[model samples]
Target: MKKKITVALLTAAISLSLVACSNKENVSKNEKLEDTVVVYTTHKEEMLEAISDEFTKETGINVEFINLKGELADRVRSEKDNPQADVMFGGDTSTYMQLKEEGLYEKTEPQWKDELDKSFKDSEGYWYGTIKTPVMMFYNKDLLSADKAPKDWSDLTKEEYKDLIVTRDSLSSSMRSTVCALIENNIKTKNEDAAWKYLTDLDKNIKNYYNSGSVMYSAIGKGEAAISIAVLSDIIDNKENNKMPLEIVDAESGSVVITDCVAALKNAPHPNAAAKFVDFVGSAKVQAMIANDFNRIPTLDSALKDSPAWMATDYKAMDVDWDVIGKNQSKWIEKWETDIIDNNKVEKQ
Candidate 1:
């Protein structure tokens, strides 16, 4: 009887030990999953690193990022069957809309979703805008005074400004937004032909089309080109940080404000980490930090309040329908590339 009792006690002890071991293994797996997040971004490296560092400090989750620039959207699409990144950060709302239509984004509402305006986010909570980037014209102040600089998009096509303008390649989202806004505006007021005519004339003055923003910035700074169009944030950064002789041209037609957005991938390798990252990036606190630190215009109302005083400088916003632009973006881009860019007779100066 004594031997049987001892044997029963040993069996109970072994079962408890096995159960504890299984629970520990489960906990270890979860911890490993939450420790790091992989991100694919189109944002500049400095801004990405700054935001990533802050997120790491706050959440203790490491960030590994790839700056894919123009290739970001295509890469995401190619990897739809098996996603490698946890999050997709940067790129304008229009791109996000296209991706959302393809069902590539995971619908996860960040905590700060309610703080943004309806225009800044998707109604279905697929993606959230973190920055408001205005696509506007700017010039090298040393080369041309405010009075002489192009006051509107039409001014670039003038005979006097010929060979004085440098433009980004059409692949740039900023350039696409600017061109689409002009096209949409013409479609509303006149007809599509009017928009094409304007673009064709504008192309006549182009000294060169640069595939890299940095190269274009250098060309303007060095007086190789006197005027160009760029996002307001980049203009400010080049002027203030890099000491580039740049000035903003508040176009009479107003600027097209691109809502730069963030979203998690549909079958992300680290889903929990991706959800946390999406929430953390668009949070009011981080938004405000980005605004103050990087000269970015925050999309969140509360964050906008904490932004720099320059953000309060009022300028007219182009009255273009973003939904319409999002839907026909590919078609417009294709036509522009084939007709305007490819077939242009203008020789680079």
Candidate 2:
């Protein structure tokens, strides 16, 4: 009884390089690429620069941004001597936790540390989630229809949906995290093999596999694939302003939730600016950028609204142990590669 595997709709698998430009739009001592503040992020370029520009407007801090790609953790670690980023923003909380273990964070500033969540945030004041993104089921409304869409976790194998669901390779860090949680819960009969079997069945149903997080939203939006698991942030942000019938669902069976946060490097070149960036993200205005403007949930209380539909719903999520994610990632990735992807065990519905 292998458990089901669904990739959360993360806003971006993007490496947001924040090149700080002054509002003056000229290279000056305080704002030039070499002289200005250096910030690093993996957020989408549009959102990253939009928010960074706002910060520049208010503070007059000269900024230079570099767009990063590939695994941020690897990049940051590899550049230990000449680390490029002062603040890492917009990655899953688990990555932050893993970095904290590696001693990457400075751990000075605190953002409602104990109050928001004891488990999620760092106790030493290293990192905190500025916005949250919960994992939920996303299906093409036209294909699934309200009645045909999944309302529960087990719906992955219904007679009608046998070959309708689509998902990522289980080896992906995003999907692997959620899968570990699923296995831990014994959701697939407390037997990991059973869980793998279920994943295989769902894998067979997938029409295609994607390498980028944005592809999920794009796929579902265009009806290229009928169903997928995604983070709420990606789905909502990519949601058409012109109008499209894309739909995201929260299952009574449970949805996995995660948050994207900001963390300062332990010896950041611009400590003052780094802390300010965290506070800025924590503010309602910035939170709104994540929620109303971007479709991710605000971490602060003021940004929340009455609506909790889809990714917004106040559901029971795993306590979100970043440490667990860091340790188990290699094991899960290896298993998924050998058992599924490498052998071409994956299928398309």
Give all candidates' CA lDDT scores.
0.80, 0.61
Q: Please give the TM-score that candidate 1 achieves against the real structure.
A: 0.85
TM-score: which candidate is best? 1
Worst 10 residues of 1 by lDDT: 14-23
- What is the C-alpha lDDT profile of model 1 across 1-349, one tens digit per residue? 0011121243242223111112223222444446666788877777778887776666666677777766778889888997867799988887898999999999897888887899989999999999899988989999998888888877888999988998888768788878888899988888988889988888888888887888889889888989998888888889888998788888898888898899999988778778888998998888898998888898887888899988877888888887778788888988888888744533333
Q: Candidate 2 on 1-349: residue-level lDDT in tens? A: 1011111211121123334444445223462232234556556666766776776775655544554533556767766665555677766676777788888888755545544565547777888877776777877777778887888656775667755665665434456656655554443345767766666665566666665665555666676768887776666655555354668776765677767777877666677677666666666666766566556677666557522344355665654445666666556556756765433534333
Model 2 alpha-carbon miss at residue 136, Å = 0.8
- Kindly report which residue stretches of model 1 are placed more than 4 angstroms away from their true locations once superposed: 1-33, 342-349
The per-residue C-alpha lDDT of model 1 at residue 227 equals: 91
Worst 10 residues of 2 by lDDT: 1-10
RMSD in order of candidates: 11.7, 8.3
Q: Name the top lDDT candidate.
A: 1
